[model samples]
Target: MSFFAGNISYNTKLDFKTISNPAAFYLTNLEADLDKNKIVILDNSHAFAFKVPGDIFKTVKLPKDNWLSFSYSLNFRWDRSNTYWHSNFFLYLKRANRFFPVIEPILKKNGVPDDMKYLCVAESGFTHAVSPAGASGFWQFMKGTAENYGLKINEEVDERYHIQKSTEAACRYLKDLYKSYGSWALVAAAYNMGQGGLDKQLKVQKVNNYYDLMLNDETARYVFRILAIKIIFEHPRQYGFNFLPRQLYTRIPVDEIKVDTTITDLAGFALDMGINYKILRIFNPWIRQNQLTVNQDQPVILSVPKEGYREMEKLSGAFEYTLSADTTL
Candidate 1:
């Protein structure tokens, strides 16, 4: 028998540095005797290593004694799809630098994991104005659903576009979903599909784990999309999405002006404040009409965009704001 198993003995040069960070380490002298064709042993210890291919180890053999039993906990329990993982991960990381801040508070307030924020990226692509299948806004609340979630929607105002209001409404809806499912993953999945749909599938499939169940392509990819987003969002720089301070979206400045009376013309009111009607709607999306006809005299707060536009206008003394002539119309 030639050197262990071969008909002929052959020696190969070993590059010690190439095996950096392998699961096992071999001494220089012992490495010379290591059989390249067979698995090597390592000194036994209760330690984990980032396994790398092709490295010799000095393994230790520990006696089986008093191994404590522990309860099984599920850290990440989902069937990972290769295709979704790659695509969604890239998208999540691409928008993560901007989307994270806006979504974090909603999760914190709702008692959901902050990781769920990536679902927003998967839903709206970090755009507040995305409209897919008639779903609207950053949270993608549909008209009927938005109304159900306590978001006001009408011809003049759509609160779905307001970040804080929409997020709060989304949290309320999510809390309800969680109360129904008791699992964040299931809640997220149900958020994509309705509670009725998810419940029907759960009963039909006779399984609860999201990954194991066969679903419609969109629903199947849903949880994977969320997980991929969580992965990339958690480690943005690891995936080559780095941005400078100035490149990210900054919060706009505005002052809240509460109105308890009728506004005959919002365009005029906006102009009186030295701003445009477009800017007025841009800041206060809750204002649903070009003219606020207050029949009930309920005080509605309007946020007027400040800083660059307002401050300059204030300095120039271009316009001044006054209460509408008719308090009720």
Candidate 2:
């Protein structure tokens, strides 16, 4: 039997048993197993799903490092409810199917851990977003930080929104941060709050590690938020999410088109290439404006979709998980 909490029904199984009148009187003496001939068994399988792992993630392991602590554990417990509800965590689960494939290789190639892919989900929900503080894109780099990492961010182009380039840039940034801090937890915290801020905090607090240092709620909760992503997503079956392979969005495939020349109008440029402006934008989100004023100074590269590939808009409605977001890092 399935159970519904707040209109979201969890995949579950129900068991009903009955015995003959004479056998019913022997219930207290009966065995729990199937050896009894008088007992009726209902073996309907709805699939077992739990909103939260029944053990409350007791078996879910965090990265084994010096950083895992009582405070971080508490933070994990506190932050996990956001994932338990059908709303927040389910959205990440659906999108992870799409974005994880894209970002994982870049992180791995850059020598970052595969587990770090959860950071993207935490950063922007894998949505191209502009934070109120003016951070942008998948990795959520602010203006100066992005430019420092070699992402072009200006009126006509903002490669911070570019998945490939920005992911590579993030890998590089994380690599540098990891070198200095020697801890992924601290690197993540430093990513949220600048390296300078983290340095100052470490000095003031006299704490050498991220777990021991007290920080603003945002930075303090940051690593645990990421851990929460790690737990629910890595074990989606335990977290009560059930979807067919087709229902999950997969990696978007496209052909790369390099543009070094100035294009007065990108719409016309897209049409000449046999796709609409919207499709072009979906492919080349880094192209921020309708017009591209490209010159020898900097070339604008675009990822135009291959012949058979479809944008999310063109895909079957049933296949997509349409939802909203609050993309704050």
Residue ranges of candidate 1 with Cα displaced over 4 Å = 1-102, 130-132, 286-289, 295-297, 309-329
Best by TM-score: 2
Per the 3 Å backbone cut-off, how many clashing residue pairs does candidate 1 have?
11
CA lDDT of every candidate:
0.56, 0.67
Q: For residue 239, what is the lDDT in candidate 1?
A: 30
Residue-wise C-alpha lDDT for candidate 2, range 1-329, written one tens digit per residue: 12223333433321212322210112232222223343333345233334333454575434445435744555554445343444666566767766776777888888998877878878888777778898888889999999999988767778887888999999999999999999888999999999999999999999888777889988887877777667556554444444444555556667878889888788898889878776777666677677888787677677777777644455434233211133111
lDDT string, candidate 1, 1-329, tens digits:
00122132223333444533111212343234443443333444222221111211122111233112100101121223223244444443444444466677777977766656667767876555445466777788888899999888765567787777888888888889888877777888888887888999999999875645567877766765565444434333323233233333444556878788888899899889888776676565556568866555567778886757565434243222222221221
